[model samples]
Target: MRVAIIHDELMRRGGAEQVVLTMLKAFPDADIYTIAYNSEGTYPEYKEYKEKINTSSFQIFSKSIKLMQKFYFPWGIIAMKAVKVTDYDIVIISNTHCAKYVNIDSKALVFIYTYTPFRLAWNPSSYSQYNNAKGVFKWIFDKVISCLKYIDFKAALRGDYFLAMTEETAQRIKDAYKVDDIKIIQPDVKTRNFYVSKQPGDYYLVVSRLEHYKKVDLAIEAFNELGLKLIVVGNGTKAAELKAMAKNNIEFKSGLSSKELADLYANCKAFVFPQHEDYGITPLEANASGRPVIAYGKGGVLETMIPYDVHESKCTAVFFNDQTAESLINAVKTAEHLIFDPAFIRKHAELFDENVFIKQFKSFVEEKYEEHSSSVIKSH
Candidate 1:
């Protein structure tokens, strides 16, 4: 059967992009469709599949267009709507935004795998940029978001089946689209690429985009007060502001290869994850490296990381309840004193390996497609 994969954008190396890459492995022959793609900006592995990748009209612009794409929501919507996947037997959308609006053939089944309902449209208050806007700007922003939410909701209804990365995301999809039937298929980590190091490094590691919502600032503040070394990897809009806030003990690095990142995860004393994510991959990546995580005790992390307070023997992370630096500092201190078993951590992470996701996802699609075909035959 012919299959087509649609993703919102291939502009960066992120969890959602990773999911799309995994999907490609499941359906190697599937053509990929997206709103925008930046070869240099996103995963280098995508270059190998360049022949099968297709982008919208916006692809003519430079990479900077991705950063400003939020402002061109209407154009993005139009761009996706213009994409016709009418010939494919199955259209699997790896969506966090407008990809769901893509035109699909009535004979085909569309499976939408969401990272989360578009956060900027559904949960505006969570973004610092939205919260910092002025009276008129904020008013305009609110109105625009309201309109986008309506459009997003209508587009979501086109999916024959919906899948989410985590339970948190499943609930968000339910709230955003009022859709009751949803499947939860968590994303995976490349556990085999990582190994437990003989010796741990002196510095704590943070591998996340330096964004306002990521709460990287909290890690900087805690490390500054503790006078401990922190190595932060990844860059974003808040990069400059976060660098300015960090002290000499904090160091920033970006653009590391998969092997290099796995090495850092293997050697670091602990991985610091301050953000509340839809379903965090970094913490699991850390676990795959046989390292413990120091994370905020909320959101998707709760489902993955075994917290020390709850299950001391099985714990893979230390959880900080509050979002403040003081709370994180306390958790860091607690982590410093605890003994974590690298072997056990690695074993736990193996459950969410890339192969596992591929197997589960392919099975779900095949089973559902069979059911869909049977129904169509009955309708005739």
Candidate 2:
């Protein structure tokens, strides 16, 4: 079958972008459709996909447009809708943002792997950019945000089927769109890249964008108070602010190769994840490395990490309920007292491996395609 994948702009490599790459592997022949593409800005490996990538006229202004994402998002939706995907038999939208707004023919089978309803639309509190606006800027923000919410809702109604990334996201979609019958398709983690280390390192590790909603600040604050060695491995808008707040115990590094990341995951005393994600893949990556996680016990982490308790000898992670430094510190202190079985944690991670994802996602899409084809035949 002719297949095409639509994704939000590809300017950076993150969990959402990783999911798009996995989808490409699932349907290797599928062409990728997006509003813009920046080869050097994202993963260097994406350079190979340059031939299969189809972008809108918006790509011509990629540089300036990306810097103004807040203003360009609606334009992106417009550009995506203008691009036709009717030629493809199957259109799979890997959307954390606006790709679901793509226009497809009625005959084409379109399935969306929804991470969440747009955060700026449905859950603006989680978006730092919007939450930080002030005075006149806040007024403009509200006006644009309100308009986007309306447009986003109308666009969401166009999907033939929705495949949620987790139960948490599924619930959000149901609430936001009032749509039922959503399939849950979790993203895959490459477990083989990581392995258990015989001797764990002294420092704790956090590998996430230094964004406000990611709550990297909480991790930094907790570690600072505890005077524990912490290594933060990612760069983002809040990098300078986070660095200024950090003590000598906190170390920051960026542009680590895959091998370097894998080694850090393998040897870290514990992995820290303070954000509420739709389906947090980092925790599973940590588990794959046979290292326990110290995460906020909310959102997708609940589904991924096996929370530590007295009864579970082979627990994988411990969670702090509140999004605060005090809470995370307490959780960390508690986690230090628990016994984590490296083999058990790695085994648990194996359940969500790349192979499992490919098999399940391929099967789900094929089944939907067949069913939709059968319905078309009956209608005729």
Candidate 3:
């Protein structure tokens, strides 16, 4: 079967790109379609099989599609409408906000990696730099965003199937779109993370997009209470603001190699992830590095992390039930009290390894293809 994978943008090397690369490995011949790309050393493996399907004409004038993803749904339609997608028999969309854009085929099967798009996209504070303009340009942009999201939702009706990245997203797709037959696929973890061994490094580590909702400020507060060293990694508009508000325990660092960060992970006292995540990769990285993850409970943490009980002998990690300074401070203290076995921690992390994800994802996709084909024929 000829397959095509569609995505919003490939500017950064993150979790979604990793999922597409894994899919590329499974279907080496499947052509890839996206609005923009930044092919540094990020996707070296995909270079051999990867092909870009251009939609630049529409993209040039509407580059705001990505910037205004949540506020204006029209960016998805503007970007997606540019593609001539009637050719591929099977089209899989790796989506958060742009999944509704792929061209419909009678047999088109869209598997969306939705990370609570409604919440992520629409929250003004969570995402800055939207087209918050005025006059005719602002009015035009808002209208476009409004119309596009509506179209995107209607376009989803044409898709043969929907696959969600998490059960939370699946319920959302069902609730928002009345999509009944949603398939659940967990996010994949990078196995290379497990290569290092833990020895309780000097600084506590945090890695995520520096968004307002991530609550890096709360982490700063917690670290201040304990007087422990903390290292913050990631970039965003809030970086300067966060840097200014940081206490004596906190330090900002970015642009580290995977191996270098792995070393830090192996040595860190514990990993402090203050925000609730939608299939977060950093916590898994902490697990792989044999460093315990202290996450804010709620959202994907319940599914992805196995929180260590404060009393456990070989405690892996701890969770703060609430998103507060006091809760996180207590959780951090709990982690400090526990004695961890590096080997055991690393072993637990291996469960979400990339190879295992690849194998399972490949099997799942192939099985779905056969089932979808059979159903199509039966419908005739």
Note the Cα lDDT for every prediction shown: 0.89, 0.86, 0.70
lDDT of 3 at 342: 67
* Per-residue C-alpha lDDT of model 2 across residues 1-380, encoded as one tens digit per residue: 89999988887768888888888888998999987888866777678789999887668656653354745666666777788777889999888667877778876788888888888878887777777889998898888879878888887887888998888899999998889999987898988788899999898999998787888999988998999999999988889999999999999999888899999999998999998877888999999999999999999988888898774467888989898899999999998777788889999999999888899999999998999889889999
Report lDDT (Cα) of residue 66, candidate 2.
Answer: 31
At residue 183, what lDDT does model 2 achieve?
94
Among the numbered candidates, top lDDT falls to 1
RMSD of each: 1.3, 1.7, 3.7
lDDT of 1 by residue, 158-254 (tens): 8989999878889989999898999989899878779999898899999998788899999999999999999999998889999999999999999
Cand. 2 Cα-lDDT? 0.86
* TM-score, ranked from best to worst: 1, 2, 3
How close is every model to the real structure, measured as TM-score?
A: 0.97, 0.96, 0.86
lDDT by residue (178-226, candidate 3, tens digit) is: 7788777677777674555524667888886676778888998878787
Clashing pairs in 2: none
Backbone clashes for every candidate come to 0, 0, 3
